[model samples]
Target chain A: MAKNGNDKSRHIIQFIWTLITNAYLIGFIRGKIYQGKIKNICVPGLNCYSCPGAAASCPIGALQAVIGSYEYKFSFYIAGFFIIIGTLMGRFVCGYLCPFGLFQDILNKIPLKIKINTFRFDRALRYLKYIVLIVFVVIMPLLITDIIGQGFPWFCKIICPAGTLEGGLPLVILNDSLKSAVGLLYGWKCFILILLIVFSVIIYRPFCKYVCPLGAIYSLFNPISVFKYQIDKDKCVECKKCASVCKMGCNPTVNPNSLECIRCGKCKSVCPKDAIECVSFNKRKTN
Target chain B: MKNNKSRIITVSMLLIGVLFLSAGILRGENIIIFEKAINICLECIGIG
Candidate 1:
């Protein structure tokens, strides 16, 4: 009973953070972006800084913007923020903070049966996010410049569904003059966002699992982060229940902090001995 | 040795993160962070 209760509360916490991060509700209604000093800081999740409702900027997008512009030096602030958060908590941001992850969780809760990905295929696709992190967010932004020495923010322009959903869709819908600005690129991004939404309904966080460069970066810190998944071997009964409940397909008994493990704590309740936990300095963290 | 190595790396990362985080505020130009933050960046809005 306590386990189910804890899960409910965890869901509530994640939902609350989602609301907090996207809390500029009036931004959507007014169709204007939030322009405040708070916008300078990067939120730890995949929330788009340009989202009409966003109270803060995105680190990855900020990094790309710095890299693409000839006027500014490379971003220490953006990179540092990511590294700081990544080293402290790893992908806990994905589990508890990401609005898109919440979106996926809500979609997965629909009546249709969920699809579990095959291990081989899942492993193969996991590398794609890293490639995207390097190619779109890093290389393309720095290398491909126009006459003014400004390169494109490839990921935001070409692939990031978050930007399209949070920033583009609402702005275009609300503003009349912006409609004339719409072109083929907007159509391409809309198509991509639609596909990702459809997949989220069937698959467990397809974007976080296979396409999010931010997740790719954070996963690097999972093994080294102060807050981490710790297994108490003495308490283990060797039951596979933890693995069974994992939507991201991580085997908790083997590697609890797998790259794809969003640290959602679904596996913790399934552990009969309470062998699995996310802990720091020997103290368990309440999600 | 492995544990020591990871601790070393962790400490190093923390130090660097602190440096980088502060660098923007102290030594860097505002154009880098604000240019993106202040504007309704076209790319971020899914526009070309």
Candidate 2:
């Protein structure tokens, strides 16, 4: 699996966009969040709404908030917004736009060569994210609520390493009051985040593959999203070179459009036969 | 036959997505999202 020639500059766009979306690093200097109109609209990633550097709302947290609000039901607006993102881009957002995914990519780049690529193990674990999406994100919030019609956002409060990383660490470290008040739950989330950070270095995008409710949701639209990662079977020589470069361990030759694929195009970049390419919407690609 | 059926289904799904987006705009989802986002979510960050 020779590296792609463009790999040198391939991630620059992701890097730049990651920084730009999180560009409110100025707030970190002042120890206050950006309170503005832009925070109302959702950004299509796992960025924490509480991150002082954040300019927009997190879709997952917003979804949970709407559900746990006095309404205690699905927000047609949130559902509709997500459906639009899902149909338009699918996990391409995970591939290119998500700060959390970029964080995983950066951690994986930290010279730790441990790879967890046993076929069945990887495939089996992908289902866990779907379970998280259904049970933690959807079911629990709707089913359980306090007297005031507020329910805990189970995934964001308990499981989201993104929140623990982007929002929790920053808020606690910056604010003396918050730091002094850290409790068992904070410690617990810190433990989960540390474990995830370590695993992200060893295993590619373990959270996205195994636990992210957003990833689970986006995956449902991958097969039908406007953007497509297509393989021309006519040109594919069955060399399986594409899988070698795939962080998600997909055989892009056989399953270029697999649900687990983030559509990162690392495989497309590495394809020796020029077999793989991303075909956009509005045209039928027979791959 | 298969491709046509798939196209029809995907088109319908996309149309529904459009409807959802419209509903979001009409219902002022931005206001709801803004309120949740502007506040420092103590519980979300694992605080009480």
Candidate 3:
């Protein structure tokens, strides 16, 4: 089935609901007022597990725990969860879900609207996210050790605005007695969050483009993702409209599976050539 | 085409390696970093 603009908008709205509810912001508020147990739904994105209001575990955090566990060689649960989600829908998770991605989308809606038309630089910079995935997510925690011998989730500490927004702020507000303990790390996180918010207004999805390790992981499955886009060469006429409307800043013609393409389907909706279609796994041929 | 294909293959290999390696590293120990550090550090400072 073809996607319309309204369908895209609905997806965005649903994404917002998922974010607010899944972040346990709602539960946090409820739990705070009623003294009820905080309930959290473990969604696939990088929502922080430590958010005081959080009812569910962050998938990335869960994965990290499984990895760092001494008794178990690795966490089958976290790995299986990511693999299942990834293999099933791939980066459709980024396009259809992901609160952080939605937040960036909202920020990118600011009407000043100066487009930074730097295609080559954008493509080159997309690789930086992979570097983040490697260095912060993988290497630091495994390699670096303090004198007491504790591993760090370097990515969560150094990056991740979701934690700041969801975990940091709520906890601060709730626990007034805990207010005086501010330090450089909080300042740094606030600085990064502010930077991301400001950049999101100017450049679309600055985090998704440059820093999101989760997006980087999902992008790997783009080539074989079940929810994929197919372009018809026979229908010819490369007007570049698809590329232009793409919020993810990808050329659907050249690299339909681009890590930058969130599969948001703006291109598919606007294609004058009627060239693009969403491909399902069950269907063998592109219609 | 060959160079492009090779580059993609290399990138894919590297990504898979990194994912496994990351999963390995993050299994059990929950050392706070990034935003978690901010939250914890804030809590430590009596802010959060």
Top-scoring candidate (DockQ): 2
TM-score of chain B of each: 0.62, 0.81, 0.51
Reference-based lDDT, residue A25, model 2: 88
Deviation of model 2 at A53, angstroms: 0.5
Residue ranges of candidate 2 with Cα displaced over 4 Å? A1-5, A282-287, B1-5
Q: Supply DockQ values for each candidate.
A: 0.57, 0.64, 0.09
Tell how far residue A159 is off in model 2, in angstroms.
0.8
* Residue-level lDDT tens digits of model 1 in A1-287: 65577667878988899789878889899888888788767789888877888888787888887778887547777778877898888898888888877887787767676565555688789899999999999989988999999888899999999999888899899988787899999999999999998888778888998999999999998888877788888787888988888888899889877877778888887778889877763443243
lDDT of 3 by residue, B1-48 (tens): 543553455456445645754654465222322223223433222233
Give candidate 1 regions above 4 Å deviation. A1-4, A281-287, B1-8
The candidates' interface RMSDs, in order, read 2.6, 1.9, 8.6
Residue A99, model 2: lDDT of 89
TM-score of predicted structure 3, chain A: 0.86
Please state the error at residue A240 of candidate 3 in Å: 1.7
Sort by lDDT, top down from the best? 1, 2, 3
Q: Comparing only chain A of model 1 with the true chain A, what is the TM-score?
A: 0.94
TM-score of candidate 2 restricted to chain B? 0.81
Model 1 complex DockQ against the native = 0.57
For candidate 3, lDDT tens digit of each residue in A1-287?
24466456856675765655464455466323111233212466666656554445566655444343334435544555565566556788877677677777777777875755455687788899999877876667566755644445666676768777766666666666544565677777778889998888888788888888888888876776556777788784899988887777789999877767777878887887888877754234344
